[model samples]
Target: MITRRAAFCLPALLALPARAADWPLRPVRIIVPFAAGGPADGLARMLAEVFAPRLGQPVVVENRAGAGGIIGTGAAAAAADGHTLLFGSVSMTIVPHLQAQPVPYDVVRDFVPLGLVGSTPFVAVVPASSPIRDVAGLVAAAKAGPRAITAANSGNGTLSHLATELFNARTGTAIESVAYRGEGVLMPDLLNGTVALGFLTLSTVLPHIRAGRLRALAVAGPARLAGLPETPTFAEADVAGLEVDGWQALLAPRATPAASVERMAALLQEAMADPALRERIAGFGVLPASADRAAFAALFPEEFRRWGDLVRSRGIRAE
Candidate 1:
């Protein structure tokens, strides 16, 4: 007596497609929230090229830089179609935590996390001629002359700035912070010794570090960098409570279908496993890191809370 109703429903369910087709029926646009030639832009290009073939559509990378990445991110947030996605980074997580007004987008509410692409550690460096040979010497100098040691970063509320602040808080030192439009623009001052110290990615300072123009004091991670094995980690350097690493990720406008999000995550995970892709990404000085949708999505709220606390305690304001 199960009846005709049960018999009719079974066949209808069986007729459903075994598996969904590859989405991205047309060209896809990836919005990079930074200018060309920068790390974010470079990562976006790499992702677009790698992701295109997987989705069977051309993936285009576009730079929409303004207001410290707010404009581009906002545009992506407002985009309803899944065709437009955002190449987000630490800035995306850190900015809103500092802004007085509510940010245009909610990291957890407005964006769907696709995956974590990778992370690169920043190195603490000093001019080649400086007597500060290691972390201890640099800390001693900063302690002796509060606010005398100046460190330059891309801008306020940026990873570099946060790195320095975290260092200061941990070491109990008062180091001055100078913010610039971008890391590229801050190089001249660093090379010329206008800035006494700098906390930047090893990629940004690799040439100089290899040229013997700047000496690496320590890396802001748990372990030493593969490229610079001799340099010690923040923990090894004995800098109390200091550990920071800059990262990049991919996000989509909220409300994208779960099927699409899962598809992107699976493809990205596959791409990350490709040896050739791994080599290329490592060449940029970032290790290729990937996670499934659930794992990646879990990180946003934690990051938002951590950065939010720092912003409130330090009173960081966007410039």
Candidate 2:
């Protein structure tokens, strides 16, 4: 009953287009800038375990480890596809500014913050025997003897050093930086009162704090940490803008598709929501990531700028 023109149109309408494939056609390689066997590397493996079976591909963490993470970060910056990701840290925002030479990538320009993992705050800690019991007390003591108070750090450009710099700037005090080979040597000095103070990683100092070997004055975070609820945040302690912590996160190359990034972010948040994972992370004195991706990403630029200014002004070097 169809007319000749109608019959001719029916064939064109009946032709079907081919289906498009799902994303991540192959294994996804996650680059960790630090060396293996470290806490960061351990966390990366934990995440990869969650991602691999569900991602429909093998998820691998590759440690590129050198130049304070510049080597692997540069490799991540050069990634051309969504399959390559970076399990970066607060160091990504820091190490570049510490370099006298220009880094291979710009933190903001080269990558987008994919998701937040967690952070271990820098606690203002003193030997249990010290008289200082709070931020005000610590500040007063430092002010009493300018440049006489010792703040321990593993090296010149580490987060501990930067936190000490920020604390000094915020409190209008000058505490001298005391460098150590690593925490192994530094912890003993702190225990024996050879070092008066340290803005140290909570995980590294938590046991000591709990064991009554070191006293935590204030935690550099938005609010009091669950592990140290009695310890107030810097703001609550009357020191605003003194928050300092080493955050762990994922970032993707900027050129990666927006859809893919969104999907990955959702996946990360879902993984972070696991109660067991959060508990495990918290057991190490690290706080679990919040569900707010936008809020977390919004913080990156400010933190990046803050650390950069401090690094440049302090003339921090890699050695």
Candidate with the greatest TM-score versus the true structure: 2
The clash numbers for all candidates, in the given order, read 0, 0
lDDT of 1 by residue, 117-233 (tens): 888889999889778899989889999875979999988888899989888888888999999977889988988889989999888887899999989999998788888999998
- The C-alpha local distance difference test score for the whole of candidate 2 amounts to 0.85
Instruction: Quote each prediction's TM-score.
Output: 0.88, 0.90
Q: Please give, for residues 93-186, the per-residue lDDT of candidate 2 as tens digits.
A: 8988877789988888899887788887888899999998888898898999768689898788888888898888888899999999777679
**Candidate 1 vs. true structure, TM-score:** 0.88
For candidate 2, the C-alpha RMSD (Å) to the true structure equals: 4.8
Best by lDDT: 2
Q: Please give the lDDT score at residue 100 for candidate 1.
A: 74
